[model samples]
Target: MRQYKKVLLGVASIVLIIVLAACGNIDDSSSSTSSSGKKTTSVQTTGQVSKSEYAGVIKNGHYLTSKARGLTANRNSNSLNITSFENGLLGVSKSYYSTSNYIFQEGQYLTTAKLTNWLGRKSKSNPTGLNPKDNGKKNSSRNPIYVESIEEQDFMQKNGNSLVLKGITIGIAMNTIDYYQKIKYGATYQQTITSKERVAYGKKVAKLIVERMRKIKKIGKNVPITIAMYKQAANDSLVGGSFYAKTQTTSSNISNWEKMNVENKVFPEISSTSDYASNDNKSFENFQSQIENYFPTISDVTAQAKYVNKKITGEQVTITTQFYSETEIISFTNFIAQVAPKFLPSGVPVNITVNSANGIQAFLSRSSTQRNFKSHVFSSY
Candidate 1:
């Protein structure tokens, strides 16, 4: 492992205690079935709390395109906490909040649900090619996958024994594309990855994840981050590895490798000036351009850990500090609320509120990319 420089990107808004005065009451009554078998509810009470108190963690969370690829996380943390499974079978929807009593899980989080709806619903010009006709009735059954594992990594720069710094890494492994293909195409499917398609989808997922998480922290700032996709070895030159260079050595090595391959990879495909001038240089440049044309760029965080010591030893223990800005927390929360509704108790109502200052501006900001993403609960009004 190599050391990377740590930078302070930006400070989150200070918590200013403001008075939010609101109150609600609830009453409940229970009844049992007299005739056959099923017991039903008589009366139920639901309450609302201040936004400041809206907090909880939903575990075993999953999204269904076919089966589930568990993408679980602490709703309050930026590090996407995930579990590892061999076939990418993990949870999709589990609800957790710090302030459980205050935050009502009965109704859906308005902004979160919309974002999720956008994720599953197909669009007329979806870059991923997933559409309504594509995800149809052949694959009818659906269930939220349960999570099995969880791991955290320390990614922090320490100064002294006083513990002046801290950071964390959370990862979730999933088989999302499996479900996507099964439901959309009526059979389990795997992504066909050409180098171009891989690069394009990789970039696409990276961009989306960044944009998705950026709501918490403006991306490319001080947040030292990395993401990678995990799949069986394809070409086998390298297994699913770090997306970008983590250490100086790795970065340099990757640069050298690219330089070595450039001549054979870039210029040999070009045509001569005579052919260019005579035949108009008909090339596959456009076909070869695998830009952000895929969905959910499969990725894992490439967290860099730093140290204050110049020496190394087996006894040496490194500590890192990681915290989520309120924005990032809300962004992740909204993401779960939007995408994980299918796993909630059956008949659970979901309402998404966005397009306002306090609503879900994070995802909706990408309006051009999310045209079909509409509000079914809140916007219904």
Candidate 2:
């Protein structure tokens, strides 16, 4: 009986050892995840659904008050309101507030909330009147002129009187000359001018010119808009003859001229609208969509019908893309041509041919080269 007891004790020790080993292994490998001989994670995505598939509510509203004074933003509901401004201009002078809540799915925000708040008040017929600071005064500004080169002869012709030139505004043209004239001739005290008075006016004009030039710099870079002023004796000598550039130097001066011209002369004018429209409207959304629709989705020729307007035969869509280099254009075209087919529905056949002048043609009004290029490409389509 004693020998049997000893054997039973030894068996109990072995069982305890096995149980301890199993518990240790559980801590390292079996904590709520299957061990597939690969690294495991506690992150909570099943990976069956796409990250963008998660959805949330997005609501917004706009209210315009009958007073036509101000607009308010409702951030909680993701909405905006415009009130009492039907009679006034379209703008909200007051600051707006908003709030948002979002959820992360696969490290992406899949849900959101927002709130906006707004306040309104009665507005004046002339908003400028309500804002006592504005006082309905016109913005004071100086005109700018660009000259390739300034020489002594050009200076002599523009002496003291103002004149307008081609390809420039009257205000900017005159302002440039005014700068040099004051610097050269010292003014007398009184006669509606004195040392301090002249200095004040000079500083005021200079500041305006500098501000306008900053704008020009933003638009034209260092494109070099030169200002030149000349001084020549008056024909009668007693009239204090002065002829300035064709451009005026101040906004007030320009306004006066415009008002006068309407009643007096048919002035010659050159507008910069074309250049501004071309450069500034490059990324305009409306224009971008006009070209995006033409992209074909299938590789087969029959697939082209899916992208082509069925009602219109031989319809060709022209895309004007601004690219710094021709290589970028080629790469973009090839990328679209290659990838578009995979996304198309099964039956449609499509092809994309990039015309060489796609970038330049967009800027030109009616260049013969662009017309000919279009003719060559569409002749086959």
Candidate 3:
């Protein structure tokens, strides 16, 4: 019996050792996580803290409230309200308390002076062509006109019944001398000023913003920045309209900045009856299908279509058809002029061009003026 007791004691010692080892491992993991400045429980329970929780923490915080006030003053909107805040997170709403109005506002946490300096750099980079003193020459001013106002705001997008933070929009109002000239002289209509020029100027300003933001350590590495350039008119209001460009910092720090353009001037919602509001791609696809079924002999031809929305001349569709032989060109053009129009969106003008296998080209438009075969086609043959 004594021998059996000695064996049992040895087994109990081994079991105790295993239990202590497991407990030690758990403690070590917890300590490591805490040491790295992460709450193990919080991290394990939820990868992200809820916006509501953050709101509760900073609901009555004085510093954040002051910041919120400053944001409102800059945006020229009294609707901005800070509803929530956390260490590196902020939530704001405009007029409503719902998520749709709520914008998630967070960045590298820049000082007022730093933000001012960043805007100053952008001002210096403005293209000389847009400067009044240069008269559209390539003489960029050493002290280029800076943005009149700068504001950062989070805009929300509606998702079903709820609203989600879309992204941060940096609004900068620029009162360039050329912009004032355009407004006073209606140069925008005179073709002296163009949307392309404004878009190019907007891109330069956006590049500066992206460059400065990337240097900040606290800003989210993948967070996108949209720079909106608002042209201030003679009335002192930013009414000349705005152009914007969006950019994001990649892991390699190379920014693939998209071409800047005027904000979506195509108001589909307001003009539901307009053909420009219709899906051009879908219409083009249906037209191609009809052509294949109606004329099997020409079915092998490739057809491509594009829709363009011009502010002044309205909506236009361009269709290009490639024929297998010169003989098919005439038949194809006729089909495009008669049958293709039926599949197109109503009220939209279309220009159809037929390219023959022999390199001959003929174009026909809704108006008779544009209907012509190129003179080079006969000369080439």
Candidate 4:
């Protein structure tokens, strides 16, 4: 399996560290009632860091997966967009559901079979498909699958003995480019989807999904659902796609639409375009340059920098090295730890992974809430 270098999960997540100079720390917990109306022992307490826990589940440490897991696994083709689509949805969900108040569960309502029908071309038999009906011709305008796939996330709140649904977030991943083969083992043709066309189709699917979901038995009819439109990158794109806009259900339909500016861009590539501010592009260039100049033996040096509202949020630097010795990896990672903070985005979580032919050789990361970066070197000796 190809390991996508761009993924630096939890970089933008909040790492709340309450020092409690005066009062004690406040812990995020949930209370639950027994099925027979009896009270169970409260597992939550307020104080310094004791152990990792979540609010709503019967278990303390592990999160519960949806009863239907991996049903929509075949929806996405690109490896980069899959990770981004999943993690990015949670980030977008933060606006609607606070982590302290809600626990997350995999999408519970939508089944793989349901999603398969929705992603297929709309037909007389499969009326729920979001794509336009397949005409005989391969015209770019009529042939493409406007809606690539659908992703759902369910946020739950502790109501009684069980965790009830608080809200739902659905991501409509639209294809920027669609590939098709007219005949079996024939020439493959490609079509490019314009931004306007993608948005129109994506919004159409969103409306249809909301309307269809309202009829479902499990999902609440008027549940507060946050739907986001993501323009997926090309199949071969190294960086993942971005969430450009989001909206919530005001009534039965989507309303209060808002544009989002979340992006994951190649650090050096931004210099050629006016995507991000000049300051960040230059910082990454300088950081990349220093490593190249000093460590000529390094196989490759690349960084995927995330920008939200035009400010750098997090950047992942992958340094591919030919050296396999533990001592050499330790030296290279030590240098990276010292200079990364100075050149990369300040105070934001930055992950640096050093890779060799054997696998991950070393790793370094600094959380957004901290000043110093933590480093680890794998022992290959």
Candidate 5:
């Protein structure tokens, strides 16, 4: 972990001056730029998803937005799952829609309202409902809204200036717990969903979804499709859950579902669990302890690390603070900037968010290519 923390002092000043260095939901840019100052995500050529242009540049400086936007907020009751469901879908899509072959684009086939109806419970009013009907039954086993939300990602290949849709990826956000109210506006009771049942239901929904996309959406039969299942984390859970399994289709029909041993666990979680990456947890604990020791005013420090095949891949840490002064924020950020790479696991991108009760104070990220962190201090005004 410590070996990857070698500090590069050459570009420290230049990095700190940049406003926003990467693309994300919370950030300004939709394109990702590397340390070399060139946009690492772009599709300058036509035909096949270009590796250099994975994000797929639509215009000179603009990026294309999916037909469906902002509907994600209504997808899950838990905010954490919403973020996980969206980001994790793309993460899983990279495997099937390789950037080397296809450029990235938002799902264009599904509409916000259509998705809303699909996620809705099966009923006379909404025939597209993917969730099982409640049938006024008080029992969860008999009926529950097991399917939470749906997401789509389109993979494109360039032909001259125009782009060709080569594939469509769908993400099924499934619930681990079925929260039901026996009566309207009554007490809510949760029915725990087992892993076996969760995966089985997810596959059924995926196949059915593809069938509809072809019949109704007019999707070309030759366009490849990928389907991934993401397990939604409990609303109260600190970290959002991750995609567990994915299946790819050559034509229109999905086949040979492959199991993905992916998971997301918050730091300071149960260390006794078999999945616990012992060394990684220890490093996070040390990082938390150090922050606590240095800044007593900081409220808390927590990390959500993603594991693939039992190995740590990426981590996002949040530090809640009581400080407001820019000097104090920079000072604390500098301290974190110095100790983070030294104490935390490396070779994976790590993003740290410093937050105040009001909102986000600053954001710092270390990409896999860089030895140091690129940061932005939000304006206090």
Candidate 6:
């Protein structure tokens, strides 16, 4: 009887160990759930939250937009203490510019409704056939789409190692123009003008504003000016659309006449004649060719690269690649950093971000003083 009890106990101990091991395996496979019932994966080492968590924080467009505007308006300091999610997602703080006082004065002449109407007049198929009007309209008490504000901010370059403080951003708010209707219908204004015509018009508007701004004696004569137009659509609070133009004063003539000149004589060097300011389209084409010749694996995939003077970061190279697995993100990002600069204008510092179908997979940035790129991996899948 004693021998039989000992054998039975041993068998029970073995079965208990097997059951515990199976439970451990199940726990390993399971993910933690948030209060909203969303599964979350924690990176214990980096303490980085999942992309969904980051998106949840950023999706509050009103709050984010207000925060960005407030940060730009406050002239008391240079640095801002952003939350962990923002830091992790954006990777850097103080990347945007605060517009100078002179630009704000010029903004008074341009209202959102007026600009829209101006574009409407320029449109080839203006159903109403509105006449082209000069930008002398009184500042409307309420504007549907207007230049709400301006700011001067910094831009990161060279994988985030260099910083450029020559960015001027014009904030635009679209309050009307079927603001709510477009959301439900999924259609915005149909383009009546050719892409070339639209670009020409935008450039003309920018040149006029730049001319007025140069009249301000406080601004330097040789300042390399980077003008960015950030537009917030009525339906969306975030800056969904942006346009850019770059120019510099090569002439010593700082007279009122020189400042008033709207012709090409005012700006000796115009970086781009397009709407977005930078020479991104040509650079993108060149980058595509380089990729095809060098990296065959991703050569056939459709890729797009643009130099964006972001609100938070002065200037950045945002690249969207064809659907790529998370594991390949690092390799691809390194490859881009190596080849992209070759096609872009030299000496302009800019950071790089790699995006896939899933979302932003990696961010490579450097401060102006740093030489090496500090990379942040967000999502692999």
- For candidate 2, the clash count comes to 55
lDDT of 6 by residue, 1-381 (tens): 000011111121111112221232122222346899875532111111343211111111111111122211111111211111122112211222222111111112233333333323223444321223323332332112222223332221211221122323332111112221124344443212333433444444555545654564544354434444332222222112232223333233222211111100101113445544234446655766765554334423232222334212223545555666556666776776677556543444446666656677677665545555567768623
lDDT of 1 by residue, 55-117 (tens): 221111211011112212112111211211211111101111223332212111112222233
Which is the better candidate, 3 or 5, if ranked by TM-score?
5
Alpha-carbon lDDT, every model: 0.24, 0.21, 0.36, 0.71, 0.72, 0.33
Full-model lDDT, candidate 3: 0.36
Off-target runs (Cα >4 Å) in candidate 3 are: 1-60, 63-103, 106-108, 121-143, 154-167, 176-198, 236-240, 244-381
Clashes per model (N, Cα, C within 3 A): 45, 55, 2, 0, 8, 30
Which of the numbered candidates is closest to the native, going by highest lDDT? 5
Error of 6 at 65 (Å): 12
Deviating ranges (above 4 Å) for candidate 6:
1-281, 292-315, 322-327, 366-381
Of models 4 and 6, which has the larger lDDT?
4
Q: Which candidate order results from sorting by TM-score in descending order?
A: 4, 5, 3, 6, 1, 2
Between prediction 1 and prediction 4, the one with superior TM-score is 4
Report residue 376 deviation for candidate 4 (angstroms).
0.7
lDDT preference between candidates 1 and 6, better one? 6
- Return the candidate ranking by lDDT, descending: 5, 4, 3, 6, 1, 2
What TM-score, computed on C-alpha atoms, does each candidate reach?
A: 0.24, 0.15, 0.32, 0.81, 0.78, 0.31
Best by TM-score: 4
lDDT of 4 by residue, 90-185 (tens): 788878887777766667688656776777777898887778888767666556877765778887776544567778898888888886666756
Q: Weakest 10 consecutive residues, lDDT, candidate 6?
A: 258-267
Worst 10 residues of 2 by lDDT: 109-118
Task: State in Å the error of residue 39, model 6.
Answer: 41
